[model samples]
Target: MTETALLPGPAVVASPGDFPDWSQAASHAATRVPDAAVTATWRALNYLCAAQLYLNDNVLPARPLRVADVKEVPSGHWGVCPPVNFMLAHLGPLTAGRPPGSEVLVVHGAGHAGPSALAHAYLTKTLTLTGNGPGWSAADMRALAAGFPHTRAYGGEITPLIPGVRYTGGQLGPALAVAQGMVLDAPHRLVVALLGDGELETGAAAAAWTGQRALLGSGLHGAVLPVVLANGLRMGGPSILSGLDEDELRAYFTGLGYEPFLHDGSDVAGFRTVLAEVFARLRPLGVARPQPVLVLTMPKGATGPEQVAGRRIAGTPAVHKTPLKDPARNREEFAALAAWLASYEPAELFTDRGQPSDLVRQALPDPAPRPRPAPPVEPLTVRGEQAWPLVSAVIRERAAAGSFRLFSPDEAASNRLRLAVSGDGMPEWASEILNEEICHAWLQGYTETGRDALLATYEAFAAVNTSLLVQHLKHRSTRTVTGAGGLPNINYLITSLGWRNTYSHQNPGLVSAMLETENPTVHVFTPADTTRAAAILTVMLTGRDRANFLIADKHHTFTFPPDTIREELTNGAAIWPHLSNPGPGAPDLVLASAGDVAARELSAAADQIAAARPDTRIQYVHINDLTVLGQPDTWPAALPDDTFARLFPAGVPVLLATVTQAPAARALLAARGETARVRVVGYRDPGRPLPAADLLELCGMSATALTAQALSMVKEPR
Candidate 1:
């Protein structure tokens, strides 16, 4: 990688009441941010002037201004130029009520700050921002924007994303606080953030915390513009590779009082629909229930990409096919694109300017010449040689010994840690961002911000490991300890081990110290463990007894049209595919995945079946999906049948749930004849299994009782 370092500077963030509010700042941002908007196919011509100046990574060519050359343009990149294609799809003749321009703020890291330079160039009228760059350069756009066009801006060569005005060189963390401030301070304006997946955890946390606090406190008025180009891997875990998951993602945003929606980062239509929904939601809740949303358009990484220091130890999703990029060719494509822009002439850049207007230009006001940051705080002579070397050496040794893999081992202790610095280097907020809480958020956020597959990695690492440990205990323990309520034992193990009990709630990392590789000695009604078991079961037993409750009406599915409730049951059946089918002979039981309607109609259907076939006995049980099935493979094996005694010792029928074909055709089966009856029944249902009293009479000293065999599998095994 090309050697790089962010030119140190200031900080900023979001959340309500975070900074002073004023009108001038809003107007200045509105005007300056939009000037940088993308205008043409290669990147709208108007915004290209600014986009060209962005410091792009060799991996990113889609963005014009990024200083580094990167061959990628994430959906989040739209904040800067609104991807020419996206704008082309939505920007039709800028009709009335079309706020001067695309109201979006392109969020980028210091390494790619040059792009925002373009955002400021053309997006000024329609969009606004707090400030740009990575780490320290994070700014309070609401505060900085307060001063108006006269507002103090950064100095120096315009970075790709940084405005010539507030050129912090490289800092951007604080900028998030600033943007969030704008949303809370100026609730009416839209808040858009353009971010790569790499920037998600680092920048999003404090901002999210601030946003959540703001919403809970006073409710926010504006929208959160998080455009995550999910790129890399998670920082740590079992081999450490979590891509992302919707359950985790929605839970996180909802915790912040915002509902989340994900789309193909590059799908212009899906992106637009999500954005439109976001606007509508934020507009009404404006401060009443201020929900700052995070729109993630991850440029999924490959199945297993190398890990980055300070990132989740897990792998990132594959963004190679995000419609906006081709990883295979991005390296050269972005570099050449950057070089070509560097050769542009001033005449071609602007209509009136003689010299290239393309150079980083400051639309915002100039700042009072500021002082340099203070010297780094050195360790006192009180300690012998700072011991950092010893600590580093020990850490590396442990990592090599199969404890954990540590990246960037060569980084000096001074740099290995995070530091808070002020405008004048007064030790503003410098400190390691990693903590119990941050680690927890990073884990949960990983799920919420990316894809479903990637999250499986994290879950397997965090929760599954503990679950395996639970399974280990299940093998040795005695007596079924039912954790009645509150914290179950299994729940405790998960939460204690940093697995989230509920997907939402607090960052579970804080409770990491609670993780136990071994079970507790105390047997005092392990509620926590039991609760965890219940939660895990909830995930595993989604479709245990679909047929028991969801039997299709012999002729029709239902009296009323299938609505949301019915859909839930049908969807639940998806988890237990084995339970969705019937045997060969019998048509089906009853159709009832329809909740109350399914339950009532199913009962009535049973009565109808009884009236129609008085000779056959029919009684269906509406067992909840989770309550019924343990394993999809064995579920169908449990259907009770006596007239075909080989299937089950009882005679009954069943109806199953299949979203694809529910109530249309029930699985049909024919089996062995009961000894006395010598009649074979075509269908069987587990719901009508013979009661304990009946089992003795029919089993009559048989080799085995089938119920005993099956219940043995579901019950606590001895």
Candidate 2:
């Protein structure tokens, strides 16, 4: 292994004054890196990373050359490690001296490279281990090595278990958007998003490039340093981005409104110099809106084994995972693994006690505590029959508190959310983009980083971000299991129902997709009117660790007693006494609705039933929260058996009108063993360029259709 001499200098420490002024340091290149601490730290991280992947016992290898020391089932990706390690090592220096509020945050886009992050966390003393002996004892090291991919605290992916990992990149394309959100309104902080080349192919990633435009003129906001690790190959083969030349790549980013900086990873020292210069340039632009992107090209497995059995591994796809598959059984491969591990010279990096040496320790940043947002205030209360005015009032109140934002897919005005659009165009606190993926990701990023926000878009177009929503649900669920601190809910305002849209714009798949997750944190709320919608919105905005979907229509307006709003929200569903016939016994039929438009039709159907059959008993139920229809075991908000029985009698038949697909509502009802007695009328996607009533009638959701279904169900024998 080639060696670089360590330059002597003062020890690096975490303090506000330690950060260098790049503008002045650029003139003194020799003095810029007073020492080779970053390189030394990188070497130590590389050694620990290899240990996590290959060693199950004898982690420090005090005595080597034994098959028992090698893991029986060695696993983890190696292709993405070196670049990630390089970034992490350098970032330590850049972020070390920053104060509490201005600290730099990192989001790992290549989640498969978990070992690298785990190694860094261990070296920095930020990782929680079995025993707390300053996290440097031999026992702690052994425990970390034994845990490997199956650590009880965190799996082999970037998650909240690791400190500072706000955005989990299990799925690609949302990292950039999420990073943008972390810095939104946080002018002093900076987020460094390590984006992989393969992730660039996703539609969300493509849309995220243009997402910066939304932040350009939006007042003072923190900057996101997007570092693209272009390693030339993905899991399967060569990446599509690898085909572009340097000039072409520059043009691509330049067109997307970024000043692109291209660097070669082959020259580590040269790259570090360039990286320092980039940070220096960015330091003066604090709170200023200038999007700078850094493109770093390197080999797939830069510092790992280059070749084994005459097969090239380092730069090839073969090194994606466990380059030497069964090193313990194969003598040649075993020898190769030993040499690879020795290349980093663990003896030079770690003390005999299995702790990081002073050389490595001095290069690392102090473990800064994660920043927490201020506690949420009481939910805003707005009373009105107009949906936009009431919803807008809540939004305005949150914005005034300086901790809330609104993101829309350029449909805020079309959806009658004029409050989101200012006379000067998109405001600093509110952004309107044309891509739903970006809008959803931005809100997710904002909320996960300790603030509240909402994404408002047409219900049909909301499906565009179904994948993003599911990813977030999984992310939040994992956070809950790990006991991470609470984060505000991801609130979505779903509007422009299919009943009012053309065939091309008619799909309620977003709701169905969310329901399919069966995640306890997923809450689908369908408020009946503007008053109810406002109430639901306020509750969701102030809640935590949930993904709340508030479905309501802005085109129509209806008034309900403001006093009853709390009861409806609490019960999820409640009887609308005014809309039902006076009765004390079990009703012949129950009329229920779970959406605004569906509620209107159901109300009209109730009038028809009451007028035609004054002698027949009837009851009306308005469902403000749809999850209550599910079994209590699956969703916490789901009504218990007794409550469900009381609201929906066992003997009486029920006719439900919902905006979601009928099958979805049926599935929820099936959980309660009530599917047989319930008749559902909902969107079947039989939409067209017709009037609202015509569309509803075509889908069997019209008031006349609902009335007929109710009458027929009541006539059936119990």
Candidate 3:
């Protein structure tokens, strides 16, 4: 009995089949291929059919397409059919059986061939292709299409969508979000979802979880869905399910996610049969249960390890082989294409199909050169996505009620700092942070505006976490009433840094800290360097400080006359190689920050410093979290491998130097100094190290001998 079958929550493991693990599947795979002849023929046929189709569509020429040329066409190089095979297996045979007005859809995004061709052929009501010819290789698809009876869709745009069935394109990572929107918008249509191999592993999987929640909320249970997987190799990555650990698989699907129907791609006929069965089972009981059914296929001959043909064949580039194409691949693809299609007697196709054809010849709407530089989105630059009219309620909600409404700064200096250094984290704090980021992004839009401009204002405020440092300073400031009755420059201090997902935690601590703030400048810093300094300066001076942290590349370090800023250390702590920065009789406190100083160390050093500073509380404030500069990890290419297998929408780049990571700042600081210095804390905001009594009190603990004895801390507040 697997844990997934017994319990709920995220299960990291699962069985792959009736068996418990992959050893059984791998062994099963070894026996399925049976013989080499079948594998080779299947591979050849599949490739031949695909290459010819691509060439007829004016994709790769089938002869010599320069790697550069092959790369030119959008979504051309990713090899279509990975997402199409499953769709084709189910929808292909159905083309011949649709009663009048029983419309069908070929839904998918960029690069998918099977769905595109099938849909293209059927809508035109023509036999675009027939797998038969005089010198047929059985792999010939163009000749087959040459025999089709297809008619052009309205206005030759392949649209107005099937009146009954629609083929909508979607991007990767958020399928269910779209599904959610879709279900609400068109409550009458049958929504068939098609996703590729790695789709389930992405953030889009979150949508699946949400969909599950919606199903539960709507009181619809056991809603089965068919999630077909083109079980091709996991491109640029390893094979999924075909080789995943069983327990892991079971945990993932049966427990962590909604249960889905899984199937093999080669058994397309079988897949269709099961889907019909699953759909029939769900239709009557639906209160709108959103659980999806998943289908896995290995395309053609089950190219997965479970199947035979996809063996460890030598990695070789496949060029379309025809009498016209020499093995050298040095000839033009057109010659090869012509020779290949010639076998089918392609006479009319060259006439440019005076009637409707998928290839509309070079008679384009605009053949002139493109305009020089593209015009920009005007006025306020919007992030997230392109702009639309403000008529939508969703847009209104988004624009009006941001995740969190941020306090836009009035002064230039105060604006650039961030009040929340947020990301994935404990819930309350995460929400505050994520909300702040979203609100700031909305205010900033996409582009940076002027000194007092929208994004600029929020950005300025976001650049540094002023509220925190100001609050800390106020808490420690010799004068108890610096901003006595709510200061003019200060707005309500930020209390939480909301997160999107992953690390959400329900913590009452953050909220309590807010309630304890003695002044309007209170904030809890999340150790971002750039934003922290900006926050401090903003709260004190009522404006932002552009250069809070100095950014010096290794080479640029020597470029400064060595005295760009003078440094004079007064007193601090030392490193104990055996224990920590503070070992033996070392002083517990040190006041050091950024650039060769003891600033970016872990909290341990800061804690030691606070321990030593008794008269005042302490803080090892990580000022750098505010700094959004610096890079640590490389992108796995903006578009995932599976995203490339679409037909309408193409994969985008996850550009380098985007997305930031937490710095080993403290450790980096520790390594920089000959001796690690402990942080010194003085009286500050709730975040500062507090006395035993103070700590107990803030956490809602009682004071007194008995309570102290029970808690083990019966001393005065430090």
Candidate 4:
């Protein structure tokens, strides 16, 4: 880690009346942060230079800036750069005096200007701490500057897919939620969240803002200071919040119970002073309540070029991206770009050797050791219909040990998780946010912050967070490969499956979509019974950098014994030797099942085959992991062909009863090169409002249908 201390220095102070109309004035006289402002200006220059490289593929001062150097397709947003740098500037001085080893996290919500974040990290040498050696020099900086907005390099957005990033940025509205999760139980830590003003228009962002109600009076011990980068512009036009005056903005946040502090960048010194004061007042005093603060009125493109091509750029929607794209075609625009780059005076900010000067180093926060990973919780022992009850016991145990949280979108009681609710020996163990997006934000935020947590929701509605799921899975996959420590296994307890609901709720497409990605960090566990679910949850809660989905029913169901569960969980599937009828040789047909209902139906089908056709030979295999049926190379849980053959010999007809979509099952079999021979029966329709038993038959997922399908396949010649 690098040793950097940001010392406060003199700054230019402006009166409240100096700001633009509709912007609020500072409450008190401003304090100066000359050093921090210099660092901020230096970072703003880097961001602008990076944007130029991404758009034109050449730096401003470089001689012979040519059309050939310009990228065919310029990418990356530049409008938000000024605010991103502005917020980070003040954060440096705030963390400067903290004790060594204190935890301070900066979660950037605007990721489109990912290069800005990369630039800031590089300048501070935080990139080096993340194991990116040689990133501190001018040569490396130039290399990094030229690579963004290109698929072959850093890509266009900030993602956990890269080392040192704790949150995902391309997708808007989840950073605050992620921040909330990180601060839980760590009263001494400070989590600063920077959200793009335009992103606040998103429903997820609104949900996350109002959802802070759950944080209040909940005994949480961390501070979340949300800095809204109020740049007033989205991608194509003005944001919804951009039109509101300072009073309206203050009222909006105040209505949500936050003590909003207004800041205008025209007075950067004043803004920094207010920001420091806010942190000082909110620093945890061992309180069990949320400390929420908001910074409003951040101008977009505060200090870049004023205009280009006879069009106003700075502080306008036009600045949302590169102001002068295709610079090779226009000599005047190219000249303007060069002059703009020179305005930052980079030579004064950096030493001749390319490293940041002492002043810059002093303005940068020191990097601490990566947070510790979640400890493994003891496995729960309860089985049978008591599976969920045992889960409640485990929740109590984990919550008592601290660092455990449970979130639901108004489905806890429906999912039979009442025991894990607040109180009942599990204070703060559960929070019902009533909105899937909000719940997902909380779950992702909490896990990203180094704790264990789970979200229970209807299988159908789990798709509400489809966008979040995809990004989170990608992030987890990155964490796994990069050894990006500090993330915990994010578990989704998906119940109220499609089979038990009508058309409105009968959607099992999430599983199929997840399978389509085939992400190694994503695992689907359809445990046979409550006991198996308990066992699966035990392993899931303690796992790291993975998305574990446990699909089971909320109703009472049959369960297999512990012995079989132990053996099957090892390879994801195992034959039920006692129930199988292989005779002295291999069976004539094989029956496999996944999920609670599918397992029961398959078991019943086996009994039907035994009674009606005494001479038939049948082998039964239960699937715990749906992905295991695929080739091992494609899926980490996949069973080897030889292991698969042990249950289904070559030339034998196979019938698989699955709760997932038919396509997903077939896709897995196809990956194993068995699709041509295997017959799959799974949820295939928007079910009618019927009894549970009738619903199964309506979709041909019952024992009678399974038996008929099995017998027909068995009778056919291979």
Q: Largest lDDT belongs to which candidate? A: 2
Q: Candidate 1 has what TM-score?
A: 0.29
The CA lDDT of each predicted structure is 0.28, 0.76, 0.27, 0.68
Per-residue CA lDDT of candidate 3, range 1-718, in tens?
A: 0000000111111221111111222233223322232222223323433343333332223433333322112112223343443344333233223222121223332222332333323322232233331222222234433221123321111121212122222233333322322222112222344555555555544434433332332221112233545444444444355465445554566564444555654443355455445544433112433344555644422221121123231111121011222212433543343443344222222222212222221111111121122122122212332111111111122223212122232321222222222432211101121222222322221111111112222221333333332322332221222111211122222211111101221122322233233222232222122222222323222222111212211111111111211111100111122222332332222222232111322223344333543332221212222121111111111122232111001211100010011122222223323112222121112455455446334432212221222212212221
Off by over 4 Å in 1: 1-42, 45-111, 119-169, 203-207, 214-223, 233-242, 283-294, 298-718
Worst 10 residues of 4 by lDDT: 16-25
Candidate 1 Cα deviation (angstroms), residue 584: 99
Candidate achieving the largest TM-score: 2
Tens digits of lDDT, candidate 4, 200-294? 77887788777777665556355667788777778777888888898888888888667788777666656656665675556341243444576
Which 10-residue window in model 3 sums to the lowest lDDT? Answer: 1-10
Could you tell which candidate, 1 or 3, scores higher by lDDT? 1
Collision count of model 3: 103
TM-score list, all predictions: 0.29, 0.93, 0.33, 0.89
Candidate 2 clashing pairs, residues 3+ apart or interchain: none
TM-score of 4: 0.89
Of 3 and 4, which scores higher on TM-score?
A: 4
